[model samples]
Target: MRKSYLKLFGLACMLTIVSCSLDDDRVNFQYTPLQITGASLPDTFELGRVYTVDVNILRPDDCTLLDQFDVRRSFTDTTQIRTISAVGIVLDKDECAALNDSLQDAFQFEVLYTKPYIFRFYTSDDSEGEPEFLEIEVPVKE
Candidate 1:
């Protein structure tokens, strides 16, 4: 009787441990990775040409659709004639880091005016780190 009771107790303990270890795989995890593939404008633009700037966001390997905004852009100097639409996106830290490897070689637009033009893309939270800036020389159209 004593041995039987001990065996039952041990079995119950094992079962409890196993049950706790099993997580519901059916439940989707909330953590999703976001990334940016490329963001740029045309290489050349005519004077006083109004063009829309395109910012591209890439979907993570595990997800589809880049429908989030943690990325924003602003002109460093206000004296420039260029303007960006208010419809900018934001990206999370994880999402930003995922693109860090690829962003170095990403396409960049050249500022073609006499005034110094700087485009800055900042993370959602400034406290996270300093914002990234792209300085381009706006060439004066002859």
Candidate 2:
């Protein structure tokens, strides 16, 4: 019984040494997130006329990418909201990892009715983190 106990202890020590030597060499990094600093849109709009809004974003670094762009319109009552139509930006993997750290992209959409509409810009990063938004009011005129 004593010999068996010694063998078990010796095996356990060898396993521990082997495990300690198998450390990973890869480094993990936490990057700064992308932020929507501000937005620019027309103070008023005419019904059926298309308008463009320029959205300014502050990126962390060149490696940061714009994962998604969701432009939505809502009412002041907070009971109705609808997504505005936009030609989705198609970018390759290389293009997404751009060298620039800031961007001013334009989103085009039209309004059908005149009221107090709230325009919201929802953006995400390549890291798939929670999105940041820029909300503004664009009143439609008759």
Candidate 3:
């Protein structure tokens, strides 16, 4: 029994040492909220149809890449308002290049409801550190 216990202890120590031998300089990344500068949407949408909107995003640095679009809809109201924002992946690195131009991406969504959709894109923060949005209402044609 004593010999078995000694073998288990030695095995645990070896496993710990092997795990600690992993590279410490592994690539690190974080999800960051990106600013939506502008969006090119259609004048109107037809029901039961799919549409694509080109969204312009303000890239803070070259290390930032488009990750996903955060689209939230208000179920409490029947207005069909959707609050959308762009999220980016920022690589945690010591050196990052600055971006001079904005990046554009396409966002595709299907129109299910006949009511108009009020799309509010998150633009930037105001003077009081409040979030400002670019609101656009698009009517639907049945």
* Candidate with maximal lDDT: 3
Give the TM-score of each candidate: 0.32, 0.50, 0.83
lDDT digits (tens) for residues 1-142 of candidate 3: 9999999999999999889956688788999888999999899999999999899999988889989999998743556999998999999889999984599998898999988999999988899999899999998999
Candidate 1 lDDT over 1-142, as tens digits, reads: 9999999999999999888855554433343333334446555455554545555444433323333343334444544543221222243223332233322223334445545443343322235654333333343342
- Model 3 residue 134 CA deviation (Å) reads 1.1
Clash number for model 1?
12
**Which prediction has the highest TM-score against the true structure?**
3
The CA-based lDDT of model 1 is what? 0.42
Error of 2 at 72 (Å): 3.7
A best-first ranking of the candidates according to their TM-score comes to: 3, 2, 1
Model 3 lDDT, residue 52, Cα: 97
RMSD for each model, in Å, please? 12.7, 10.8, 2.8
TM-score-wise, the better of 1 and 3 is 3
Cα lDDT of all candidates, in order? Answer: 0.42, 0.59, 0.90
| Deviation from native of the Cα of residue 33 in model 3, angstroms | 1.2
